[model samples]
Target: MGTKPPSPWDRHPSRSRPERAHRERPTDSNASMHADHKRELRLYGLNAVRAVFARRPEAIRKVYLNEARIPQLQALLKWCAVHRIGYRVVEDADLQKLAASSHHEGVVADVLREPAQSLLTWLQALSSDRHCALWLDGVGNPHNLGAILRSAAHFGVAAILLPQHSSLALSGAAARVAEGGAEAVPFVQLGESVEAIAQLHAAGFALAATVVAGGEDVFAAELPRRLVYVLGAEGEGMDRGLAADCDLRLSIVGSGAVESLNVASATAVLLAEWSRRGA
Candidate 1:
């Protein structure tokens, strides 16, 4: 007699169970590539997700919420329902998996990143005699960008500029760090330094390159009324050619034993001083 049909659970050498769809991981290389190309990010943490919803709900594509935080996110949920944005009540583990991080405080959002416009186009449209902008040169850290944006927003910076190939593209981490400045600031993409310098000069913006030395002390220098401050990466500062084209190369003076401050901290000090002078 044929043996009882092999049970579905029975481990057979020839038969294997189909993989569960839910088990797919975002950590896979292909998934990471997709995230980069799609300009999408999974933002985690209640405050982070809440801030996006409060500031730019339209940016939110979908939300995966932990069941436990339903009460806290009521307003957001109501808005999602009204907007027809899909949301799912998920287990904490599911959220952790989606974020690929343990820091998710019970919420995750898949949001659309607003594409940055060219500086030439955006600059022409924006008419201002006195405005401040930040240019990041090789400063690819998301957290630093977020911090700079926070300071920029507080001090009324009008725009953020980056090179055509800058790696510091907007990300959820930066947005979360900004605490909402991401919605307030307009990021502008610029071509090479020479072209950008000419364009800024034509637009009547004085460029200031921040450095550790060989420049006027930020406290003593007279900052420009319409200025663009360029900061560099963690170890390597601004390129020499870029500095040469800048109208002013300024240095922040500090008495700390450390050689230099981090980019974010330096940005706060500089923006504060500039704002204080009404520049």
Candidate 2:
């Protein structure tokens, strides 16, 4: 399928760096305290900003910037102005204090944690015609999450669900790497992977686990129209109970020259196969 047109929010031109996108939060009593109750988090990069703005704007309370970084923050500021979001220019040192892991890249947006939803509710809402979902468990690397989302959107997978206790937010790098795939696909965070899998099975979804050992050969296995593909983290695969719960454990046939495929790469291969089977 051809790439979908750019989202309305993505029409802005790229300057020195991508602009951040985000929504606003109220400054009143209960709301302010709620925002404060959560740790003040900082997010850099354009797409991460966009995800916050597009998905949960109220969680974003402030945007800190520097005059020299004006171009990098133009679009985001414009978005804030139009949406009545709060912002101010602060010192680079202040930006440093707010952002934890990486360079603030001349911008940092204060945001509340992105909320997670149930896998069951998300799945139940999909049309019967749209029945495939990518279920990720313990796959914490943001890059891997973004890549898998990109593949899921590319293959028209119905939705992508991550365990609630696991890493589910679209991190800075993941957002950039997703190239807006984060917006195209619906996302959910589950309370427990094992329970979610069991519920999915009960709902008639044929659970397929990507595995390294004995299981059905992915390419040769006939897949059900309604399917959920479970992918585990790097090195270790899914836990025993979860693996056994799946309707089918699948391996991507290889020469064994390598022990196994990267979790993200394996997901891509499996999702592509499911899409192909539908075709």
For model 2, residues 1-279, the per-residue Cα lDDT tens digits are 222222223343342233453356555875766657564455665555666667777777667666676665566666666665556666777777766535556667767654555776776676768378877777878888878877877888877777656645666567555655765787787766667767777777888877887878999988888988888877777767777878888889999899888988888898888888877
Q: Model 1 shows how many backbone clashes?
A: 0
TM-score, candidate 2, is 0.71
TM-scores for every predicted model: 0.82, 0.71
Off by over 4 Å in 1: 1-37
Number of the predicted model whose lDDT against the real structure is largest: 1
Off by over 4 Å in 2: 1-41, 54-59, 65-75, 89-107, 163-170, 191-195
lDDT of 1 by residue, 1-279 (tens): 121222222333232332243545666876865665488767776766877787778878777777678778877777776776667767888878888777678888888777898988888888776788998888988888889888888888888898878867777677677877777788899998788889898888899999987779999998878888988888988888888888898998877578888999999998898899973
Clash count list over all predictions: 0, 1
Candidate 1 global Cα RMSD: 9.8
